[model samples]
Target: MVPDTGKTLCADTIRPVNLPEPVAVREDAAGRPLMVALGRRLPVAAIEDCWRVDDEWWRARALSRMYYDVILGSGRRVTVFKDLIDGKWYHQSY
Candidate 1:
């Protein structure tokens, strides 16, 4: 169950969403990741929630995803995802 803003999640109904696949990447000489990860951490109150979803179970190339609804330091809402099979991270926004 999802908890609305200012509302609490029901303890007995707590479900463990599958955490996104973890990935490791070194910073480029151009410092892109520094501009991507640290640059995208959320603010204190704006992040509404995180969601997880998986798809393509009927196909060989399924994608398992976990999305984070993050309010960036700049007040922009962004979504980040992790790819389970290849262990990589990605991001998007609406």
Candidate 2:
């Protein structure tokens, strides 16, 4: 016994979440993030952690990226990654 609702659920109604977005980043000689642009330039205070992921080699579009968890000068923490394949930077959050 449920009340009638005028909404229908289908594939069209589904949406993805937490998708990564492109970002501008400046790196040091060692390829460490020195600054990131999130509307404005934010200097990286420290790198909390770093890792690399290289997977799906069998697939046509393989994934290879270097991820960095950094703390900004303003005390905000963020996660950014550099696509090793395409050489582009993106920001993402868990």
Best by lDDT: 2
Residues 18-92, model 1: lDDT tens digits:
443333322336322322354534342344676678888899998686555655557666556556576576666
Give TM per candidate.
Answer: 0.49, 0.90
Kindly provide the TM-score of model 1 when superposed on the true structure, using C-alpha atoms. Answer: 0.49
Candidate 2: TM-score? 0.90
Model-by-model lDDT, in order? 0.54, 0.96
- Candidate 1, which ten residues in sequence have the lowest lDDT sum? 26-35
Residue 77, candidate 1: alpha-carbon lDDT: 61
How displaced is residue 93 in candidate 1, in Å?
3.4
lDDT of 2 by residue, 1-94 (tens): 9987978889998989889999999999999999999889999999999999999999999999999999999899999999999999999967
